[model samples]
Target chain A: MSDRTDPPGRRSTGKLIVSYTIVGVPLLYGLVATAIKASQLFT
Target chain B: MGVTQLLDRERTVAPPGYNRWLIPPAALAIHLSIGQVYAFSVFKNPLVERFGSSETAVAVVFSLAIAVLGLSAAFLGPWMERNGPRKAMVLSAVCFSGGFLVSALGVAAGQLWVVYLGYGLLGGIGLGIGYISPVSTLIKWFPDRPGLSTGLAIMGFGGGAFIASAVSDRLLRTLAPEPTAAIAPAFVVLGLAYLLLMTYGAWLVKVPPPGYAPGGYDPAEDETGVEARDITADQAIRTHQFWLVWVVLFTNVTAGIGILEQASPMIQDFFDQVDASAAAGYVGLLSIANMLGRFVWSSSSDYVGRRPVYAMYLGVGAVAVLTVILIGASSLAVFVLGTGLLISFYGGGFATVPAYLKDLFGSHQVGAIHGRLLTAWSAAGVAGPLIINILTESQRRGGAEGAAAYRPSLFVVVAMLAIGFVANLFVRPLAEGASDEDIGRRHRAEPAGSPG
Candidate 1:
């Protein structure tokens, strides 16, 4: 929930970015890695 | 107060409901029983002997089970929060015990897929649900000592393996000469026992009473300042710090799982030039080290704060893995000690992380974020073992001598820990404006003299 009209101090774009990066990157990495590993498993 | 006022009040403060001490024992019951999953390797050796299965094939079963643990938790978090932990615990008990029953039948009938579906899929769902059920509740109950409280619950998870190893070993010996046949009866008995124990734990679990706060709490001294705002589960997922933690956990768990999955073989390979009995003993020692680390290092995090504690884990873990590679099995004592420290840090990483999450995001929807974060564990469960297996297999094929086959794998773990250390460095207190009203309520409910 972004405080769109709020002043910069009240808003936390940095926190939003950090959260996305923290969860998103690893999730992507895990998915890619799993696909690779699963392919190896079937092959 | 009217319903809206009551709801608003609860949004800020804890609703009166349950005992705090009951949480840890409940956690212990579930964790200690589920810890059997880690001991699946014991079954691995036996299965290969009985069914003539490949090591990779057997390992895939364990991997699948662990993956399901994470996936199930992601979905189960909301339900657990909605219904309270009692229902969740009961469900876990049934699923976990029933899984074992199914697995027992699978072993008796010599159906490998049955074992996978039973233990891997069903039992994993139990693990996922049981794992997260207590975390957020405990944090709410002990907002003053989130790290210590969460650590106590998770420590049981680490220690559970120790109990499983001993019990499973005895059961295997008594039930049948072969693992497949012996494992069936053992699974059946263990499943029944865990069902009863976990049900009792679920019965004991209760939420804290409304407006109650931990005694003698103080806010100023807490590592994360009271100025930090709470964030909801959805809002938490939107933050960069959340993803940072995901990476941190992913790397930390993957590195540890790498060593854990291959511990026995790694030890044996390390001392290939030495006595076989000694190698086996080294594996046992590593288990002891891993179990002890959960309590020792995580308890210490209560005093040191989470960042510094994780720094120790990453730094020490890196050195330990490197030492294993460079030492080349020369000194048994050095090898044992290094591996012990590495295992301790591994356990500690899991135990300390819940508190770290509380510090970063406040206690609001911590359960959900923690659930989401567990996806990293699910990923690592597969990644670590696969990497180790592939590397070791290739090395063996290439005619690499003994422990040398393991060197590259150790280096990979080292690199993972190094990355984890960098991520730990980036962790800081959450900003003031970001925390939600729930944290304020939790803070306000505390006694006047208590720290926020």
Candidate 2:
């Protein structure tokens, strides 16, 4: 079994930010779009 | 022998691993079921007749399923990695099967929310988990052939819809004389079959033996000169390349789905002068093209390299979309050919992405990255349908003439593919510092010669 203790790279911080950005931006877009559509449903 | 020796012996004899052959079957089970999403149009006319609901309302179920697929995969990636694929596959099968069961009950009771909850939310979970379960494992087993392995597994996903479309159509025709009643039992039967198939697949999976490697493989001999890395899922999320890839995937998927959502209508519109039967035949041909592209074009990536292959997908795909616009309703042949090529590239994009991930990030955290990136599919699922629906609805309201309304939507797809092509151009080899350290660490830490 490989040792679990060794820290890999701190660079993944950049990746994490980018990932969240990529995931979050479109997600937020979808939510806003859905909200807009839902509002239209009632109107 | 001492305990350590005994443990080592056990590791050598039966690695905490799954049978490689089992992965494909498990993948097929999940894919075949979730592929039903593509057949939602079959139910559209029926639902309108029975429930007195609008097209938009019925479409929401599909949108919800797709949206949930990404959400579940994003949230579930780490858990899947920790628990192993077996647990993930089992959970997926159960949720997927249960979704159908719930939807059946909902249909019987005439409740829309139940269908949404059952098929959309629960089935979506199955879609996400089943989608990702076999990918990383297949790559691990065939490290020397990441492109081929991932392509084989994903081909099943792309083709699943083709199978589901046929099966569901037949079931609808033969099983129940009425639309609403016919679909509920079909759901029940399909759910039970998928449960059994997925369960068998889950049981068949095992991690490869410690120190096991495929025969005749040497990392140093490869031209990509790409080395394996041991980055954790957490570490993988920190790189710019990962997010760049995410964008590429997002654009590609969205572009394809945009066309897919509007395929039948678009074909009929373009071929308005032609017979309806001919137009329907063209639609079926597009589906076949999509299914074949998943295997043929993606498998070709194994030799041509992922970057060049994706560049073709975007560049050619853009032209294909534009060709549809240029041709308008003038020539049914041009429209059919263009639409077929677009669908092929769309399926090819899905099949090619996992290999591209392996190329950039290495196989260590590929499953996680793949899982994370699948959020793009979810996003595209929503975007593609919404863009087409909103545009088409507005065009109809404005009394846009035949084929002209579709022009704006096709342009949107073309723009998206253009963006994806640019992203593909931006792709380069991962930084050496990152690549080397990852390889060195993983190499040393690996238990002997095990398949990654």
Kindly report the fnat of each predicted structure, to 2 decimals: 0.00, 0.00
DockQ of 1: 0.02
Which tens-of-lDDT digit does each residue in B272-383 have in candidate 2?
A: 5545555555555666667668878878888899889989988998998898788747876677678778888888888888888878776766777788888888778778
The regions of model 1 sitting more than 4 angstroms off are A1-43, B1-19, B45-56, B176-179, B219-223, B226-230, B392-399, B435-452
Instruction: Summarize candidate 1's per-residue lDDT along A1-43 as a digit string, tens digits.
Output: 1111223231245533443343234224423432343232122
**Model 1 alpha-carbon miss at residue B362, Å:** 1.6
Residue B285, candidate 1: C-alpha displacement in angstroms: 1.4
Worst 10 residues of 1 chain B by lDDT: B6-15
What is the Cα-based lDDT of residue A27 in candidate 1?
A: 28
lDDT, residue B207, candidate 1 = 62
The top-ranked prediction according to TM-score is 2
